[model samples]
Target: MTPVWKKTPKPTELIDRVTQAFRLAFGYEPTAVYSAPGRVNLLGEHIDYSGGTVLPFALPQRTYLAVTPRQDRLLRAVTAQGDAGASASSSPREIELGAIAPGAVEGWLAYVAGVPWAMAQEGLVSRDELPGADIAIDSSVPLGAGLSSSAALECSTALAFDAFAAANTGREPLSASDTGRTQLAIACIRAENEIAGANTGGMDQSISLRAHQGSVLAIDCRDFSTRPLTVDVDRAGLALLVMDTRAHHNLSDGQYAKRRAACDFTADTLGLTTLRDYFESTPTLAEAHQLVARWEEQVTAGMVDLPPQTDLPTARAALRHALTEIARVEECLALFSTAETTEQTWAQLGDLLNASHDSLRDDYRVSCDELDLAVNAARAAGALGARMTGGGFGGSAIALVSQELVPTVAEAVASAYERAGFNHPEFLLASPAASAAQDR
Candidate 1:
């Protein structure tokens, strides 16, 4: 595992630039800066929202915010990466407290405005009691790359505001007993979920909140609980490769909404509050199948009639596959804790990955030609196992390979993709990285 505290100049540069901008715009120096890291799901996909287990690690990429309170109820923001010359070059605008609403600001400013409005709505902060500040935002996370970039942005902003509020008012911060890091972390997560309209599980925020060096966090999204599992890959000369398909996928898209809706329907149909509730009391595959059957019947009857061309049987099979995949994720976590050798771990991990892809391809129907090609090419080129990693409708895939074969495997996949007339994909070698922390 790579050390979380690797000396990187990016954060230092971001802090300096933000401080300079804050001093120039607000005529005051920022006392503190906070940062939150984007995360990648190493195993579980679409499972967080399903109320299942997820294993996510913070990426080195992060969003940083430098803050200083103001005497007025005006909020001003400047971006490290400016928008067009107009928005980027323009001096920070003093946004009226009342005017900050959905669509109040365009582009990334929406997030800047939305954070304050959300906090106010939750009574965490009031417009009348707003902490006036000039905040400068900088991020290295790739936007729309299926990584949790939005979460990083929202969490960092929330933390900066929370820290400023606590300092200025001399009031104990939310979840802070004067200075409890754990409490502050929870507060940050709440700010993002309640204030930012993200309807997200706690995975991103928790990883951002409690990431450590040389470990991958296996998080239970249901209770916001985490257990750090050390990833010792170097002994085996293995590399975790993340391939960016460059295909677009949006969380707010209808496909995501539909999958969420299906999970909800599954809970309601089973007379349960959530899928987690249903899974806990039922242990056998037979019982699981029965539950899925009942839910499928309810869904089919209530929703649009299954199209004649559509295979309802396959659809039911897909739901069962998802349920099984959820169980497999739990098993995989156990394996991660006990597996002795890297190859042993890779084999177990790869089996699960292959199972997941089969489910996505046949059951969920979310895999695309490009995704399949990448997975196939990697596996054919000596990858132990590979699968599409995200909410897959054209996102990226991850492949498990030994270090010696990485170059050959990546090249083979790219070549296969090119020959198929698809755009060549960008491949990255990533490992379990540290989660978010306060930048001093």
Candidate 2:
């Protein structure tokens, strides 16, 4: 299957408008317009922050930006979807870009402003940097849907800026080597982490920059190394259906922060810097569980500090659960890459999905009533496997089903939800999609 990078509609429009705005503002059209996709974790929820492995595939949804260099130090940015006044017109909103410090702009603008600021800080751009030019940002990825929409925005902006720099330096057709897509991606991720203050891992930006269609990205968060597992999901007569709960998930929520704190405390208790270290040294669930149990003793005994009344048992359970879930993520990748028959692949995939949900629910303590209800309904309606997919407080769930049963499955789940006095959920039939890329 071709990755979703080619299918993003809003980014495509945004690219065109930004290119036009740059031409108007700088008297020269951009050499290239680029886009990067938001991703959905096929498996491995909360593991990214835990410094474990993650398997994320780029969605068809993405953010697009277009840009060009300028002769002056001002940066102008406009979004086709932003609050552009009648006078402002869909043209670029002129801003004194080089004058603003790292944390000058707040809210969504930080992602835009921070990119250039970070690049300047990294010495990638000199004081005489291509000043700044007009940029237009647009995206179709659902925000706060646990799909990495913010990553898409950050990456697209960074890519556009990098492309402009390369073009200005007389570098034609900016390649990965010339533009340093990896470095730019990391910069965007840091912008989110440091400037934006969201404690998310770099998985989104990494996948956005490095993912390939017909594959799953196996990311080792500790060192940022990656391997692309070529997965074939075509023969199973099955589709991965994503249902949006329409519930917003904030990464800075206390629950999320608490879990991360607990992981850190556990790692420290074991004389490790990250849970990844513990996993690497101890390869079995039993060994990991023993280590976590000891870590819990320290938290309970006040030897190790807890994150303000965090349940020791709950935290320990979460840590152990993360260990098992990481193992399953690896297994799912193997199954996807090597399964002989579609039925067998679906069966294996479904089992892993169900197992993953159980871990999230019982051990990780992230699942909610709404998510549980959806999973139950899908199972009752004959879904091969169904579970909440993301950070799980109120995002969406994925159901693996035979193509013939999709409608029945969706209706059953939606009806069950309505009967429980909830809003009718939106169900999307999704498949493994490709990573984001620039439009030709």
Error of 1 at 53 (Å): 0.8
**Backbone Cα, N, C clashes tallied per candidate:** 1, 4
Q: Candidate 2 clashing pairs?
A: 3-434, 4-60, 4-434, 236-342
Worst 10 residues of 1 by lDDT: 1-10
Off by over 4 Å in 1: 1-9, 17-29, 81-94, 101-106, 120-129, 171-199, 281-290, 294-318, 339-342, 421-423
* Candidate 2 vs. true structure, TM-score: 0.84
TM-score of 1: 0.82
Clashing pairs in 1: 70-132
lDDT of each: 0.67, 0.70
Candidate 2 lDDT trough over 10 residues, lowest sum: 1-10
lDDT of 1: 0.67
* Model 1 per-residue lDDT tens digits across residues 324-396: 6677777677677674755667688778777777777777777888888888988999988888876677767
